[model samples]
Target: MAAIVARENLTYKRWDFPNCAGRIVNMDEDLRAVGERIRSLMPGELSQRSLAERAGMKPDALSRALNGQRGFSSQELAHIADVIGADLHWLVTGAVDPRRVRIAARHAWDSDRGVRVNPGRAHDEELLGHVVHAYNAAFPDGPPPSAPLSDDPADMGATLGGSFVRKFGSVVESRLGVDVIRLPMLSTDYSLTIGSRAIILLATTPNWFRSNWSLAHELAHLALGHHGGDQAPGEAEELPADEFAAHLLLPEELVRQHDWQAMGEQGLARFLWETGVSTIAAKNRLAKLNIRYSTEVAVALKQSTPVAVRADAGDERGTFERRRAIILRQQESSTRAMPPILAEALQRRVEDGAVSPEDLAWVLDVSVDEIDFPEPDDSAAMAQAYRQAFENRPSHADLEAWLAANGKPAR
Candidate 1:
């Protein structure tokens, strides 16, 4: 007989069967144990009724199940797990799946809220899982070439130049060893740290400036160690991320070097063109530094478009047209180009038969028919060798005599 012990706390109550040795002896015990695990996952502020509503289950039924008075169906458990962002396997088996990618932070533009928000949806989690798995399979020994960036935002900003701004995503991937993938389906940018490596996913956008800012913001989250929770981050987390990005793009010392108040609109335009940041970002950075700028010029710059700013900055006509064409092409496509290292890794996995061509196509945002899979390897020789080895194996009588001589049992 197992001794059932009740453990009570301010937030929840659970039963611990000390003598059961982690075994569920009966159906009743199994239901109760599962219920306890679910209850423990719920936030202190969230009630059982609220959880049921989120999971689309009847409040009474959920309450009964949670109280160990009724059983929960597999469908109901799955719904609950999805709603709470809990791993279904872990909820059922009491173990975390190592293959799944865990997001540290997610930043997305919320039109309704008119701010960047972090929803932490389950679909994003699954997509990241596929990416992280492919990355690990490709580099089983360790990550590719890497150089750690400076922790100080100002120092880092001073080091990065115009070339880095032009190829922000690629520079981050190759130099920082952070995998950067741009997918149109994602509404948010995600940052994940798996072991010593980090991965960043950006929502596809044609605006190069916005994409750069998003990348920098996700990098800031990683640098600050903001391993996010199920809930959206408030001002405490969002403010620092924004500040870090500001310093990274426009170092305060560099900003102070120029006489912004005297340069007027043309000077502001040049600053914007040089820094590769939006007007609002530049305005805020100035405000933070208490650097006075002409209100008239600031307003005019804010109203001006990116193209107008480039023209005002006196960029070459041919260069401007070429950049515009590139931006137009980017806007037309739903998915951006994959990082070169990531593409190489996925292709290697396909060749090794560790992943299917269909999987590669999905990750690359292309059709499976478009993928060119390598020809199947010839296994005839290997099969013959295996058959010969099997035929030359020891017989059962010889194995029995060996076991007897070794003082081992033969079942």
Candidate 2:
């Protein structure tokens, strides 16, 4: 078989579903089943063409088969399954089962052990299911059915995170003790424990609502049974369960009820009051929902929040993780520091066990300066680029496009 090849010297590999881990009856029929499974985990409104593009195939050809106008070859079917992070065997036979396939997919990201697993991870569809399943098992039927929000969205995020730690810590403490922290680090995210202790490190940044959402997502990773054992961080890297954390934290039902699809920046910001999610998280989630007005609606969703200009108890953690630093230093001898913003973003990714700081810094063309941990401040800083823009500030689209061109998240 001529295997599909990636152009960018991709450092990614796929793990075959374990035939022995579970009963394997048939595979061809299972392939269709797996395709449906992958589609379920994806956002609605995505084009078959785009999905095919991700799989490195011609869309017209894929669409024809998907629409049942033609038959898909076995290799084409397997490639589609792989691109969407589906188990080929499960998709073909329905014999491998979701749990076994999910576990097999999770193992693809493993690299050595210990802190080595912390960085160099990618998050995609496969990890998303693992995270969700793990959370469902850990919490059973969703979160502890809390009453709707009675406070501001920002306040709700903080209060909920604090409340969860206080209330659920006892239950989780047996398996994973809660570390209520205000890390000197720049990022506003927390982490799940590794190896034996299974300690869950919960941190908060200035945006209370986003911070709270992150905490919930981290908790979900633990409850979902995805973060423990010898499982390396790589398995969860593709779609850093954090994305799902935000979604599960803010249920789709509540979001749809608000008709957030029609809301503009101000309206969406106002809508956050009822949903209890921050503007940033809400926007990202909105993008993933694949609603009717998504294309046009994405215009409004692309709006940016002023970087939380503060340094306080739940803020001031500069971006960059301990593990990322080790990796970046080892990878780039000439580099020594990172810009404040990029550093923080990479840090959050690391805490979420997504990407390592060193790789992020290298990718972003920044070097890590002295390891200075500052207290969380409440003031947001305007970078030179912003200052130069004067009244007509650069749009989020401009930044995102730039980041895409530069191969990094918008600064």
Candidate 3:
């Protein structure tokens, strides 16, 4: 598990492990032996000292509680039950209580589901199961991809969302005919599936690689046949989606081609950057395949920057900002560009009297005569002048930067 963790699995939860066995534990009978129950619930490898700290009990106190030498307070019992995911009442008395609840598994959307405003158990196993089935049925293994997928990860989105939508995005839209939309409303949130379309996320991560991984992650949900319509996705479907993402983003062939043991820090860094998978995803993928490699580079990558993507922007805001910048890149000789966001903010500043006419004149490179300020209450003229002020303010180099970054060579 530590090896897999070092590798970083794609989905919020590692789908390879059975949730029931790895996390949610159910007891057939109430445990008469409280100490045994705690030990049984915890992974065999975890230390007692670690469990003690988790349970908010001192080492000796935990031993006393486990040994039945001392009775635990309600608070202590709650913490203990939480750590081991035991039914507090059942752990105390060897009887089932209908009211008893295990703290760990109580939440409707715990480990994999994470957080959601409204989630329904809406994973379509049959629909998801049919995907590979459909592929197998169409081509029973003879005809592989005409050519190995050979696009750099950075160019995945082609435009707009960048890493958030890579090659799979084309399949989702062109082949599947699903709608892929990017909205600023989801700036701080991850993307979702609405019926068949994929929501290419931009706000979840500040870096491009993570956002792109999310792009692949959400695509996995759709690929796995999660028809989330208007409701949020259920926890039941999270595992497969995660597993699909890990395999899809970092294919085995790619991993094998570049030997990890051979690829030291620099090579690994290049591979990590090119692939754009999270450090955790890469580590866990390697561990899952039982492939061993140097961890020094992986650890350093983890600590340095969360931004691992070569994609244009780390998140959606970057995309929006870039697009806005791109628009103003085409300077119409006399018409310089002012960024929309900056224009709005500047307008606010002007109204606040923080920006005088001198400032506006200075920004425009013209005298006060050329700078136009509409009457205080004239909202329409004020807005028009504000926009004009920005249109006449952006430099030639600023325009070129936006164009060049977006792969559009300046004419």
Candidate 4:
């Protein structure tokens, strides 16, 4: 069957789902369901003809898609939704109103004082206004909850990452009404700021300090109207964002007094644990103080904070272990809800015979399967499965030559 293909990089892949291991998002499965929705709306004798005419497809092609005999192409589904007066988003997710998703496809820019832009990014003044408006609406008041404004930004662990995480990821959620994910991993300089829906995703799970820093970094991109556009961002924009996040996360006065050399390794480690400041970030602050990393100091620091130990003689679990336990529990107990649009779309695919019952069952969360059926005669699927199989297929002609060389006649 024909499949709905997503534009590369535009859609998230399946692995992006809340599994901590997942890294991206995609929308192919969701579009497949749109075909079902189209078919569902087009019932009766003349329905196929009506849909075909509206979508600019031949009646036979539409019939095949509706009957699950073939898949609708991406172009066909998009056009069909338009003809049916369905929002493209509705076909994709059944969640968004058409009016809400419609926006001019112009680059965001402003020229009050004539400034070069990062292209398609916040180049258009009007688009910037909408984003700013959304941001303002979410942050009508001052900044959402954050680590308490400290007198000592340079105090090793003086800041709480949990507080900052709660601010952008939680308190901000109350305002932006979009996804704000916080992941735990060692990868650095990683984040996704989807300007379209005000979505901000942060993946910095390995070190809470760095995760918190990345959150501020991504937030800076969103708030400063840096969309990164289609091109790799030049330092012209990135430096400013980095500066914004640094100022936001590390106040000037406190950073000014951070005695990097004097604090030494143990001091730095304790400060990091307390403030959620990663060593890399600490290095930068230290660089200003002319403080460099020392192996002896590092050893002292590592010895300072073992896996899990009692901060106080009364605590049962080590601080690290406690945090670990909480994370593990959260992972095990928390289930990310499937977007209603995706759920509906996949369900439609099943109903229209485009997808198999087993496939549906595997994708679903619960034991939703009741009755099972024989596997489908997915000839299209099979052909697609083997589309490139012959790329390295053994050559029959070559095989015959080899046999002749061995004094064996070809059969």
Candidate 5:
């Protein structure tokens, strides 16, 4: 068989096998390149045999493919890509799809001994994919400005004010241009980055402090550029994110300014209330800074609840109610079925006929009937409008004659 090797678009190597049924084949070089890419994507602890088992391929077959003795079918490649959380297009073509959105989250993957596995990753990727698509379609110019509000966590925490817990999400959204969505069904928080823009999905819970920490943690992932399954032994990525969240939520400078070691449970409660961080988070932050509290104070702080903390902090009934109202409002804003910016964009797309109401409803995770779509103009009205606009324009012959009559000479 005569084989003619060629390169297309500098993407992949192709082999034209004219003598054998005229079917083109990928060159061995391309196959080896793809194998190398897949190897690079796999975690250090994940063996080829283990990956093959997870991807439902025979060990020998995978080994052969990896050695460039054979090529993987499209289905096989897709299965392997899913197993490793890789982009199949990138694996095959060695080119990243600019429109592709990558989601990263802690505790999404786990390694049991030497075996790598994904535990309870949930529907984060699928849901975030829909959001990203809707958002991109709605705003082709890309998401709002994504500049960092401040590089220093202490400045960020201080600038957000004492109500930073309630204001953090909005600040992240408006200042960082990160779309923050709070979903009651999500098991954990997720960060989805598309180019420079990012979307953070916060899992809603009654504990607003924990929710705030989760949001800040996800923002940390974005800032550190950690994508899903990119890090082996997930803890490597988690520690930094947690540290970032701690600093952002409870600035070290603020913590050091107060004598926390001597401040009993009441003062600890005050700190929690003021910083909007959970008891454990505050404790960890102190431990990280080597600020030790008495054993009695530690026990009291740990045993305290939000209600008890509020009361101990000397909040009056009216003040408590006001703060409670703010928390409720913040939760409501964060837990919207769809993010406001995304919802607006989707609505605009629907109005402009770029997207369907059914699609919008599906993306919003609501029934189509529940959505209020604008009344579309009648076809006759649209036709009339087009006809009027067309009638107002000069004809091609008239424009040519006018140009000939008043044409300017070249300088």
Candidate 6:
């Protein structure tokens, strides 16, 4: 029988452990017996200490508990149960079948559906299962993808990192609720889908639309349950599960509803803007809907590169402006080396009060010069004027020596 112990005193309550008469046990020997059972189901080649580490228990305490020198507390026993997927009752009182608990937990989703918002609709588990099955069908003989992907480029990188925690931890913890404990970043590019977690990481270089698409796409993978495994189809083919996810989330109906067939690239762009979808995603979504566009004709529609979005304000708010102003003001008089153009940019930002000149210099790849800096009486005015004077400089090559001398990256 298994028993539930309180965290403080390690009290035990008899619970059924399959077909057996319930019995209460308090002896240290009983605790060792439970520890031995945990050791057996856990991964082979793992010692009591290693198992303890895996379950976040102290090594010495685990050793003592296994040696019948210490009692097993409820928290410790619960952690062990979680690690080995054992039933609490079985771990504590030697009552109740662990299998029954697993079955019950899996089935419980039907009532709650794992989607508290919409009960009638599909739950995350079912959606994930669908993707898994589809992927299996598509690639019956081929190896599965290493991680999930969000069609959105903007979010793909971060999403993958976030998804790693979500897939392994509880769904409740991952979605709709914030995890108070933040997981460290595993990889910047790829998503991790270990266990129940499903993550999608997007590159920051991509625009928000691309990021959003990647996130959505990766979510589809999890929703469809596209975990790579032997039970699914062979690897050579396009997994049916993945297809189901793509089509389901990026439904064909959305494209038809938007009348995408008649829109040209610009028109499509307009439509996407109206619909709040990225131009790239809109095109892909249309393609998935069996709509076609001429690649040759899809010329550059946006005025600026995606990188510009991350850049600061042109003359007013850039880091470059701030650094320059600070250097010029600090110098009481001109020195052999003029402030680098990078410094000028930093100075401009400092004058604008966006950031301290020092911070701006550091970011703009400038370092403090060893020589005495100027002390302009009207520091603010000098910064603003310098910003205007050098704001239009084509390049920052002149600042190379200053940057090198200061041990900063050349901007």
Top candidate on TM-score is 5
Q: Which stretches of candidate 4 lie over 4 Å from their true place?
A: 1-162, 165-168, 175-178, 182-196, 228-236, 257-266, 289-411
Q: In model 3, where is the ten-residue run with the lowest total lDDT?
A: 98-107
In what order do the candidates fall by TM-score, top score first? 5, 1, 4, 3, 2, 6
Model 5 steric clash pairs: none
Task: List the global CA lDDT of all models.
Answer: 0.68, 0.42, 0.47, 0.47, 0.70, 0.42
Segments in model 3 whose C-alpha atoms lie over 4 Å from true places:
1-176, 185-205, 228-232, 305-411
**Model 6, range 1-411, lDDT digits (tens) per residue?**
366656465544455645555644444457667767777677676676777887677899777776655677767788787777666766665654311201000111224443212222243344333323322222233222233334442243234343332131223233322111111121121222423223333323223343333334344444444433223222222234334434533445445765443444445544443333344545455656677655422442233323222232246565466445334322311111211322444455556555444544443335645312445569899889899888876556768877888999886
Model 1 lDDT tens row, 1-411: 434433231122233467755653334655677778898778788888888987777899787777666666667788888767666767776654433444655555688888866675666667666667666666664445334556677666545554476667767776667778787667677776544466787878766667778788888876675642334345467778888888888887778999876776667666776676777777778889988878756675666446535545345885677567556534633356666776777788887877678767866778988988876556977888899999999999999999999999997
Best by lDDT: 5
Worst 10 residues of 2 by lDDT: 306-315
* Clashes (N, CA, C under 3 Å) per candidate: 0, 49, 17, 18, 0, 101
lDDT of 5 at 115: 34
Better of 1 and 5 by lDDT: 5
Q: Taking the tens digit of each residue's C-alpha lDDT, what string does model 3 give over 1-411?
A: 411121121111222345544542122222226666666667777687887888676899677556644445567667777766566665666444432211100013345655532232133233222222322222232112211121233233332242323333344444434333322223222333321123333232234455455556655555444532223455565666566667666767778887676655556655665565666777778888888776655554464333332233436897576445333321221132222322344445555655555444533346877655554667887899999999899799988998999999997
Model 1: clashing residue pairs?
none
C-alpha TM-score for every candidate: 0.60, 0.31, 0.34, 0.36, 0.62, 0.29
TM-score between candidate 4 and the true structure: 0.36
Worst 10 residues of 6 by lDDT: 99-108
On a 0 to 100 scale, what is the lDDT of residue 285 in model 3? 87
Q: What is the lDDT, from 0 to 100, of the residue 326 in candidate 4?
A: 37
**Displacement of the residue 285 alpha carbon in candidate 1, Å:** 1.0
The TM-score obtained by model 3 is: 0.34
